[model samples]
Target: MSDTQNMLNDFRWIMDVVQNIDVGLVLLDKNFNIQMWNSFMQNHSATLAEEAIGQLLFNLFPEIDEQWFRRKTQSVYILKNSAFTTWEQRPYLFRFENYRPITGKAEFMYQNSTFIPIQGLNGEIGSICIIIYDVTEQAINNLELEKANNQLEIISKTDGLTGLLNRKSWENLLETEFQREAR
Candidate 1:
């Protein structure tokens, strides 16, 4: 096969892989227009590739915090680097339902997203690529663990028989009140 034909085959293979990945992939121009939407994004967002392409991201998902999202992508465009977000900070970028059987405890899927600059052929920043990871399981597990620990702390601070604060806990509270009164 000629070199050009071989390159086309490689490109097709890569595109196929990207379109089928579990993580939601979105490529948006500097103007926030959608350039590419992978199958994962289409499935979760309930939007078709053709319909999503060319539409502004914020227009399609008005629930998004426009100011915060603009700041996130703007940093990538200005620095030509990547930015990261956590589920704790922003929950989910797209309001997709948490369909994972293991993490169905949450009403919506928790996501951690990365914003990366896409370089153009001219070596300038052209667009931003967002990669979304489903982190609902981790978030749910962490929340459960935190609740358990809080319960344990409360149990430790109370007297079992009297249902009153234990000696140490009472002393700590008294000290705090005393300090406040002195102030």
Candidate 2:
């Protein structure tokens, strides 16, 4: 095979990987027009690449806070550095439904996303790539753990039978009050 054929084969393999990856990938131009939307995005958003391409990002997903998103992308474009957002910071950029059986309790998919600056051949930042990871499982687990911890705290402080503060709670409160009085 010729060198050109080898290059073409490599390109095809890369494209296939990008399209089929579990994470969502989106490329947006300076004007926030969709340049590329991969299979993960299509599956979640129910929007095909053909339909998404060239459309304004905000127009398709009105739920997205246009001002907030622009602020994030603007920093990437100016700094040429990547910016990240976790499910903890902002649940999701796109309000995709949670379809995974294990995390069925969650109404919407929790996501962690990265904003990457894509530099052109001329060494100028031209586009931004947004990578979205479905983190619903992790988020749900963390939330459940927090709730359990809160319940444990309450249980530790209250009487199981009477639902009133236990002896330990009263002693701690008394100590705190004594310190305040002393001050």
Tell me the whole-model lDDT of each prediction, alpha carbons only: 0.93, 0.95
Regions of model 2 farther than 4 Å from truth? 101-103
lDDT of 1 by residue, 39-120 (tens): 9999988999999999999999998888989988888988888999999998999999867676279999899999999899
List TM-scores for all candidates, in order.
0.87, 0.95
RMSD of 1: 2.8
Candidate 1: 10-residue stretch with minimal lDDT? 97-106
Candidate number with greatest lDDT: 2
Candidate 1 residue-wise lDDT at 154: 87
For 103-127, candidate 2 gives per-residue lDDT tens digits of 3889999999999999999999999
Best by TM-score: 2
